[model samples]
Target: MTLAAPIDPLAGAPGAYRDDLVEVVRTRHVPIGAIRTDSFAFWTDHDRVHLAHDLPAERIDNDLAGLVAAELFAPGWLEGSELFERLMTGLVVSAADDPLSAWTLFYRNTMDRLAQLTSLRPGAATEPHHGALVEGSLAGYAPVYRHAAGLIEPGSVLELGSCFGFFSLFAADRFAMTASDLSANTVRLLGRVAPLLGRRIETVICDAARVPRPDTSYDTVVALHLLEHLPAEHGAAVVTEMQRLARRRVVVAVPFEDEPTAAYGHVRVFTARTLIEIAIASGWSWTVHEHHGGWLVLDRP
Candidate 1:
C-alpha cells in the first residue's frame, strides 16, 4: 500500500539531528516481533490508530511516513492475516537496524495512543513552548539509548524505572530483561504488551530504592532518566540499591542541569561532574558522556 516512503536522512529541520538519530538505530538491531495471540486476535484498523499517540512535528513527517511505508503498510501484504504478523516482526527487526527508525516507530505509535487517550494533538498545534517541549523531550534520550546499546554486556538486565518499557523492550532480544517501576498499572500493562511483542520481561511493582531482589542478581542494572524524579537523598538510596543488585555494572542517566524543559514530577537535574561524583562516591569507577542527557556507566570496584 505504500503508506509512506523512506525519507532522506539529510532532510530535516535546521540542526534537526535527523541523521544522527538514524545512526543510533543502525548500531544495534534490537529484536522486535509481531506475534498474534489469542489475546489480541486481530490487528484491526482501530488498533493501529489506537496504538499510535500523535503525529510528530511537520519536519519529521516524511521520516514517520517512511517508517509506516516500510513496516506496517507495506504493499501487497494481505491485511488481517499471518502475513501481517510477519510484516510486523520484520518491521521490529528492521527498525532496530536504525535506532532513529525504531524511535520513530515507537514514538509515533505511542503518540497515537496518547492522543487518542488524552484527546490532545501533541504535535499538531505546535505552541512554541509546547513544541519545544515535545521536541526536546523526545530527542533528549537518543544518546542515552545509544550508549546503553553500546555498553551493556550480553547478560541479564534489571531496569529500575522502565517507564513505558521502551528500553527494556529495545534490549529484550539481546539481554534477559526485567523491569521494575512504582506504578502497578504501568507494570501490569508492560506485562500485557511484552508477549505480544515477542519479548520476555519480568515486571515488578516495587519502589526503586528497595527492590525485593538479592545483591548481584543481574549483570547490568539500568537506571536511565530516573534520578531527576527523585530527591538527592532518595536518588542516592536508589543508587546504593542499584549497586547492591548489580554484580558487574550500573547504567545511570539524568537530564543535564541546564536543560530548559522539565517533565512533570522531575525533582532535580544533574551534570557530568555531579553524576560521576555520585558513582565514584559509591566506590565504582565510571565514565560519563555529556550528550543529549548525561549517561554514566559505573563498574564494580
Candidate 2:
C-alpha cells in the first residue's frame, strides 16, 4: 500500500503532565504553576461508532464508516470507503512531513472510516506517535522540531497555545519546556503522552492574554498557528505574553496562502514584513522567511 491517503494535523482540535521523569538535568526549575486533565474522551456524536463496534472488532475502524453512511442514508450508512479514502488522502498530502499531520490524519480517517461508535476528533486523547516527519514543521521553523533528534543543547522553553502538550512533552528532552493551553481536556490528553516519552511537564489552563509569570520566565517561547485563531487584539496580546515569558527568544509560524481573515476568528494575518514588525513590537529581534509556509524566528534581547 503506497499510503492510500495522507493525514491532517488539525483533524481534532484539543489538551498536561507529571514530574520526576527526566534523567538528565540542565536548567533550574521554575515554580510549578498548575495542572489539568478534564478533556479525556470528551463528548462527540459517535452513533456510527457504537453501531460499527456492534459488528466486529477486527474491522472496527472500517465498519464505523459504513454505519455513518447508512444512518445518513437509510437503515445504515454504506458506500463510502472510497470517498472517505479520498478525503484522508487530501489531508495527508497537505501535511506531507508532519507527524502532527499523521496524527491528524489518523483521527480524521478513524472517524470517517469508523463512525459507528462516535465522531472522531484528533488531539491529546488519541495516539501521539505519528509520521515522525522531521524536516517539515521543524526545519522550516528551526527553533523547534527541525532535526530535533539531536540538535538542541539544553535550555529553558515556554510555549503558547500548547495544545494537549505534544510540543512541550517533545521539548522536555532537550530543554525545560513548560506549556499551557485554554482547555483542561487538552492538558489531560497531554499528560498521557508525556510519560511515554520519558519527559514530564507542568501544564495549566490559562488564557494567552494573562501569563502567570512576567518577562524572563524561559529561554525560548514558541507560538505556532495560534495567531490565526484570535482577533488582532488577542493575537497581539499573545505576542506580548510570549515576549514577557521568554528570556532569550520567541518563535512564531503563520500560514501564507489561507492567511487568516477577520471572519474566520483570525484577527490579523502576517507577511514576513508584518512578522518582523510584530516581533519588534513584542520586544523580540526576529528573522522571517518563507519556507514550506510562513516562518519566523524571533530572538529576544
Candidate 1 residue-pair clash tally = 13
lDDT of 2 at 131: 20
> RMSD, each candidate, Å?
17.2, 17.3
For candidate 2, write residues 185-284 as lDDT tens digits: 5555455445544567767677877778766877777776677667777888888787777666777777664444322234456777777777567555
Q: Write the per-residue lDDT of candidate 1 for residues 1-301, one digit (tens) a residue.
A: 4243333322333212222112111122222442222111112242241111122333332123233333343342223322332333223323433424543555445433333323332223433322233322333333356567668888999999886676787677788999899877557756766676677888988899999999899999999888887889999999999999999999887777654222234567687888768867988888888655688888998
Candidate number with greatest TM-score: 1
Q: Identify the runs in model 1 with alpha carbons over 4 angstroms from their true place.
A: 1-137, 259-262
- Each model's lDDT: 0.57, 0.46
Q: Which stretches of candidate 2 lie over 4 Å from their true place?
A: 1-144, 147-153, 259-268
